[model samples]
Target: MARTLKTQVCIIGSGPSGLLLSQLLANAGIDTVVIDRKDRAHIEGRIRAGVLEQGTVTALEEAGAADRLHREGLPHDGFELAFDGDRHRIDLKALTGKTVTVYGQTEMTKDLFDKRHADGQIFFFDASDVSPRDLTTAKPRVAFTHGGESIIVECDYIAGCDGFHGVSRRAIPADVLRTFERVYPFGWLGILVERPPVSHELIYANHARGFALASMRSATRSRYYVQCDLKDDIADWSDDRFWEELATRLGADAAANLQTGPSFEKSIAPLRSFVAEPMRYGALFLAGDAAHIVPPTGAKGLNLAAADIRILSRALIAHYADGNDHHIDTYSETVLRRVWKVERFSWQLSTLMHQFPENSPFEKRMQRAEFDYLSGSETASRALAENYVGLPLD
Candidate 1:
């Protein structure tokens, strides 16, 4: 027998976006039920980008989910850009009066899971065949199977926060949906080790070989990446090989301090910029990666998801509290304005930091010139700083 339930909102996906949105709505006294196809352990184990903008921190705080984040997250004031065998710093706090927090996405997800788990409404590690129905109507319902039993959740609104591969975006009719995308020729091969980061702040390096980044999850856990052919397999990259390539890219001074250790995790992620138009289709609203994706170069993926949740949560709250749908009507437009800016920033940073196989000598010189201009020009540095910390949420 199919079990039936009712809530003010039905949220698909249990990622940080879905959990954060649910927590925010719950804070506003709105009822929500969350569903995901993966189990809790599997969800929390996925390593991802660690940089968080101030707006994202505020959102987590508002949802009462920032306790662990603040206690464990590292506050970074600036980061280094290495090129031409030299290092230049972008002082984020000095330029924008703001700093980003470096807390692993895995840890952040853990925090959300711990907080929401006590509420007893999240269905995880169990959901399958989840689908949204009657999204064109004022009331929408989500149906899925769990524990070999069918479940139907009817709600006034549905949130699609499942991510780029999720079912929510696919729920939108083919005629009504439009997509824009750019898939990069290379991918980032990343590793996680117990060693401390070489530098307290992140280092984004451009070298004759490719681009590399030195980031951290905590005081003792380091995350590093180097650009590689998109077709490159993880098996070809041993722990020693990755460390050697990273050292060469970071230049001498930074490389001299590099630590070596066995990697606990390693993976390759293809870079891409993707966006789906009109994030809302009647009562079904898309948020996070379900709506757009930016290359990780600018560290905008998670922050963009947070931005989407912030906008959609506010709109939903207004609809329920004052019966106003103004924000709801303009949800897609409002989010996309900020989304495109972040996309441009990500695209620019990826272009500046990576070596393309198709690059001619002229193109390479142009890249070098752009790097030199950015390194020497305070105005250019400030612009990068502003976008990196993030633009305004509203």
Candidate 2:
């Protein structure tokens, strides 16, 4: 016989989004159970974007999960952009009066996991055949097999924080769900090394060869990436070749400060921008990658997910706290408004900074023009800074 457990919210993934919402709602006196297909260590081992908008930092603090983040996160008042073999600063703090924090996504996920576990929150990791049912009905629940037994989690609502490939999003009827996507021709070949970063602030560089980004996880640990063909194999990119390409793209001034070392982690991740409309279908409301995916160009993936959860956690809290349905009714519209704007920023940045194979000379000139405009016009720089720091969540 299958065992039945009950909770107010059944989070369909245990990544940062699921863990964060569960943390917030749990603090709001609501009960939740998190379910994920991957085990704890597997999830923690995944390396991801580290840049955090100020709003994301606030959400973590509100959830009581920012203690270590504040201590360890690298705060940057501005980031540099490079083109035409020259580096320029955006002065994010001067223009927008907000800064971003560079704390590894893995570290943030571990923090959420630890905080949630200490609060006696429930989690089912390494579960198989996870499925959501009765989603269109008043009472929804999840079913999955775990530890040689079938288990059902009945809940008042279901939160689909599972990613793009997860099963939660598919629960919506085909006729009701709408999706848009763009698969870039290139991917980011990234490496994690123990050497210090080439720059104190992140640098997004555009060279005739391709695009390169100099980022870091901490004072002593560096993360770097250079654009590469999607078909390129990791074996082809040895330490020497990878560093050489990175240096060439970064130009002499910035590359002079770069410290080369053997990378412990290296991988190539293809770029894609995707979104699913009407984030809610029945009792299943999608958040994070389940509803949308932005290219890593602007480092918006994790921050966007946190935005969805912040809006979502507020709506869920209102539903249980005061029997209010206003926020719940308009959640998708509210979330998507900001979603498209952020998507635009990521897409625009990707277009302006990356060397597209099919781009014409006219397109290349237009890209250079935009870079030059930002270099001279404070207005243009402020616009970029505004989007980078993140727009207000409505």
Candidate 3:
């Protein structure tokens, strides 16, 4: 017989979104069980985006998961936009009175896992054949195999924080699901090195060759990326070649200061914008990469996930506290409003900073014109700054 357990909420996937939602709900006296297909080591080993919006920081603080983040995360007031061999700075803090924290997603996930583990929150890693049933009914249950034994979790609600490729989103009926997507022509070839970053603040460069970004995980660890053909082989990009290309794209001053090192981690990530409408289908609500994906140019992927957690956590708390369903009823609509805004911003940034192969002379001139305008106009810079630091969560 399958062992049975009960919880107020069943969280699927152990990524940052799933862990964060579990943390918030657990803090509110709601019981949660998290299940993921990967082991803890593999889950925390994945390197991801590091920029965190202030709102995300707030959410982490509320969940009691920000203590380490606060201690180690770097705060940035502005970032540089480089084009035509010149750099234009967007003062995020001055423009929006908010700053972003540069803390790797891996670190944040580790923090969440530690907090959850300490609280004795149940987790089933290496879970197999996980399925959500009766989502339309009040008593939804998730069944999966763990430790060579079948187990079932009965819950009042289910939170599908599993990613885009996960099973949660697929569980929603195709007829009810609507998706919007735009896949870019190129991908980002990123490298993580044991060296200091060229710039103190992040730099997004639009070069004649392509787009390049200078980012860091800490004072001693640097992460850099250069745009490349989607089909480009990772083996073709050795340490010297990547650093040489990166320095060329960043121009003279930054290039002169650039430090080269062997990459400990190197991977190429495709760029795309995707969103599934009505993030909720009955009791199975989607969150994070399971529902949407934004190009990394705007650094909105993880921030968007944190936003979804805030909305879902509040809605679940209301449902459990006083049996109020208003928040739950309107969760999808509320979250999507912010999601779309973020999508637009990501699209705009990607277009602005990346080179397109199909661009005509006229198109090239238009791109330059926009860059010049942004460089000259404080208002335009401020607008970008506001979006970069993240717009207020509604």
Best-performing candidate as measured by TM-score: 2
Q: Model 2, range 184-259, lDDT digits (tens) per residue?
A: 9999999999999999999999999999999999999999999999999999999999999999999999889999
- Cα lDDT tens digits, model 1, 339-385, are 99999999999999999999999999998998899889999999999
Summed over model 1, clashes come to: 1
Say which prediction, candidate 2 or candidate 3, comes out ahead on TM-score.
2
Ordered list by TM-score, greatest first: 2, 3, 1
lDDT top scorer: 2
Clashes of each: 1, 0, 0
Off by over 4 Å in 1: none
Question: What lDDT would candidate 3 get against the real structure?
Answer: 0.93
**Roughly what TM-score does model 1 have, to 2 decimal places?**
0.98
Give per-model TM-scores. 0.98, 0.99, 0.99
User: Which residue pairs show collisions in model 3?
Assistant: none
* lDDT measured at residue 109 in model 3 versus the true structure, 0 to 100: 96
In model 2, which range of ten residues has the least summed lDDT? 79-88
Every model: Cα RMSD to truth: 1.0, 0.6, 0.9
**Model 2 Cα displacement at 385 (Å)?**
0.4
Model 3 TM-score, 2 decimals: 0.99
| Residue 381 lDDT, candidate 3, scale 0-100 | 90
Query: What is the C-alpha local distance difference test score of each model?
Result: 0.92, 0.95, 0.93
Worst 10 residues of 3 by lDDT: 385-394
